[model samples]
Target chain A: MSESRGPGRRPGRRPGVSDTRGQILTAARTIFAEKGFDKATIRGIARAAGVDPALVHHYFDTKEGVFIAAMRVPFDPAVIVPLLLNGPREEMGERLVRFILTVTADPQAREPVLALIRTAVTNEQAVAMIREFMTDALLGRAAAALGIPMLRMEAAFAQMFGMLMARYILRLEPMASADPEELIALVAPAIQRYVAP
Target chain B: MSESRGPGRRPGRRPGVSDTRGQILTAARTIFAEKGFDKATIRGIARAAGVDPALVHHYFDTKEGVFIAAMRVPFDPAVIVPLLLNGPREEMGERLVRFILTVTADPQAREPVLALIRTAVTNEQAVAMIREFMTDALLGRAAAALGIPMLRMEAAFAQMFGMLMARYILRLEPMASADPEELIALVAPAIQRYVAP
Candidate 1:
């Protein structure tokens, strides 16, 4: 509380408010990693950040909203979902694979995704969040853009994410640590087949 | 302590032993399903089954032993792992996919597997059991059999299970209703590429 919370604090509430939000996110990341998505409660996060619970509420409307911020995920369909539908239909497989790989391969983009997948398996709300996000934001939007059945876009996600989970999360075996080129070469074709006429 | 204890480490003792073994297995299965693999306690299982806590010990040597029995998963790697690894290397993908789908597609087999995957995310033992089973039986063996680095094999498994989870558990859209032949066509070739020379 002694230090100005603002970017250029002159001992004011507004300056401290900014610092408080940053502290919350940093504390959230730690708690999420240590205890996992389920056990990382808002009260715990508040305590970790040395902030009032009310301040936590002010920043994040709900626990879900807090999680969305902590994850740093850009789930907006407006950004990339349209990209999925905008391209040549025949090239969808490669484009899709590339888009997923490029985005997920980034370290910054991965944590929230890993959290989503980890929690979705057991927590009903997390699972609902993932499904809803995919349908409303990414897949559904893409399906509409491409003029394909919405079901097909969803199917593509199942196929893509299934491989991702097996490789990334479970780290099953050879597949977990396969050569990227080999993976791209082999998988691109099937993906191409799926989207190509 | 009324009946003859079966031949084992503890040595000759009670007679109602056989009945208690069955009870332990029954209790273990229910407890494992309800509480997941790790949280379900041996003493708790015995108590639920209405028997002496020591009775479970008189039969199964450890919690892991009870888990194997209750899940009806084979303890030995020599059996099921080979199914995924057998046949020509080039067709490993098709062979493995066929084996998994055919073996697990039955309603009876599918129910327990769904339970295993669902719980594995939340429970340590469930994850440990699956990881050990995959490592000792399937992945490690497959790596040794095919003479590829284990890491690549691990990657392949991530892909395989990722697909399975998306397709079977979440039933993601088109994949949920995909024709068996279509899925096989799309997935097997990629698997073949990952595992083959």
Candidate 2:
């Protein structure tokens, strides 16, 4: 297929590329949904996208990277993790709480997250991907930076995770509709107990 | 249909009819799953179960009642609510945490609950049913008994709800395998602030 496309076309650096990346992402979402995270592969996604395998790797460095892109998560852990670590240790809990709320405050921005939550509930592969992303990309960095055990970090993270589900997904009242500052005041202390350096 | 069955047949009462209630419950689950709680009716459930609508009403007085029965949740609010309220105000959080862990420890017993959680994520009607159940049957009674505003009660409940999802559904490690007592110690204080009378 690659040979038939053109004589001068290179797998890694295809010239005049316009929508190839977008097209690959479209195909990735479908393939990932159908085969799940564990079974879906770069080659399979490339084949589905009608692009070369090397091209898929060139555009998205890894499967997890592809997932992060396809899911359209607004903030990258690469940026957020460092920001979380750089903040004052005593206030990290409040910062973390504020971070989540600030990001999810916009309804349009929250769609991908809500979709991920819904999908993660039903799909084991999604769960695995989510867990990996949280532990490796997000929480692990915070734990490392604060010199705390990952378990402590995980407990704190779990509370925040629960809060998100309750307030957003379940729309549990009071917490759901409460002023963000009030909730931060209420929940930040609890989170601090786990996260405080 | 009553006449066709026979004389001496009671719409609400049939002797040696242990399975009638059970069959209705089975049918109710199916109908609820298919049409959701709002649209599933006593007549529809009865038809599916090959019974009379009067029998469903006789066995379960309301749709909420039928749902509770079908879910097979071991703890009844009538009993547990009093137990929660009677405990020391400071210990209410611990008791609540213990209650959730105890109820969900048995995987078989937790099946219906986990199922409801998963279903409620995607279905608005299911969310309504769940919110009503949690607010009315469970948390409302607790708040009333504790003499606290429902808003405080809801905040605490949301935290617990999130923990259950993270531990059971997402299976995020450490929390998933943590000692129940340790978790209770960690989370009880947070809950007490909400429920303390």
What DockQ values do the models have?
Answer: 0.36, 0.44
TM-score of 1: 0.71
Q: Is the docking of candidate 2 incorrect, acceptable, medium or high quality?
A: acceptable
Off by over 4 Å in 1: A1-30, A33-37, A68-75, A82-108, A147-155, A163-168, A171-187, B1-30, B47-52, B68-92, B106-108, B111-132, B146-152, B177-182
Best by TM-score: 1
Write one digit per residue (lDDT tens) for candidate 1, span A146-173.
6777645654565567656656565555
Question: Which residue ranges in model 2 land beyond 4 Å of their true spot?
Answer: A1-66, A72-75, B1-16, B19-68, B72-75
Fnat per model, in the order shown: 0.44, 0.57
User: Looking at model 1 chain B, which ten-residue stretch has the lowest summed lDDT?
Assistant: B1-10
Candidate 1 recovers a fraction of native contacts equal to 0.44
What DockQ would candidate 1 receive versus the native complex? 0.36
lDDT of 2 by residue, A116-159 (tens): 67667766767888877776777777778778877677777767
Which numbered prediction scores highest in DockQ against the true structure? Answer: 2
* For candidate 1, the TM-score of chain A alone relative to the native chain A: 0.74
Chain A TM-score values for every predicted structure, listed in order:
0.74, 0.66
Error at B48, model 2, angstroms? 14
